[model samples]
Target: MATALQAVEVIRDLRHSFNIGRLQMCRADEWLNALLAERIDSGEKRSLRSSGGRKKLQKH
Candidate 1:
């Protein structure tokens, strides 16, 4: 069995690999779904501001 410290190190490495910088814009919905399902590492909860002409992703 792996030690606790070793497991933590592996998790940290995996989290680094899952950072948003690694994905393409075309996969945003897939990423969002995975994030909602707790399958991805969302570093923080930040709001995305929609431009004046663009429709927002959420329904009010």
Candidate 2:
């Protein structure tokens, strides 16, 4: 769940990376994956911090 700002930033980065990849003749998928992973990890860290480092358990 990326915020609006984060989403916009991702889009901007994607375009930049795409152009660089094209100029360098490299694959964009790898770059895209790394960027997405970084964003996800950061989002997880933010959520954890917001919850005071305590996660609630769910019952099955």
Candidate 3:
């Protein structure tokens, strides 16, 4: 899991092309969750679920 400081840094880097101040106004969990959800939806990433749960995970 990312520390709050690390998450902030990530959000900062991602905001380089946008409004940093506005980006900073978002809650860290909200940003992180959205990023993860996007990656998962793209089918380019493996779910973090254990192998035993992977079959179930694929239902998503």
Best by lDDT: 3
The whole-model lDDT of each prediction reads 0.40, 0.49, 0.56
Per-candidate RMSD, Å: 15.0, 10.1, 9.3
Put down candidate 2 lDDT per residue, 1-60, tens digits, no spaces. 444345446766876876654644344445645644664676764553354333411210
The global Cα lDDT (0 to 1) of model 1 is 0.40
Model 1 weakest 10-residue run by lDDT: 44-53
On residues 1-60, what C-alpha lDDT tens digit does candidate 1 reach at each position?
A: 443234445655665787635345326546445543442133222222222212222321
Q: Which stretches of candidate 2 lie over 4 Å from their true place?
A: 20-60
Better of 2 and 3 by lDDT: 3
Off by over 4 Å in 1: 20-60
After best superposition, candidate 1 residue 26: deviation in angstroms?
Answer: 27
Among all candidates shown, the one with the greatest TM-score: 3
lDDT of 3 at 25: 53
Kindly report which residue stretches of model 3 are placed more than 4 angstroms away from their true locations once superposed: 1-26, 47-60
Flag the better candidate by lDDT, 1 or 3.
Answer: 3
Residue 57, candidate 3: C-alpha displacement in angstroms: 24
Per-residue lDDT of 1-60 in model 3, one digit per residue for the tens?
Answer: 553345557777777756657645567557667755665687734543323334433555
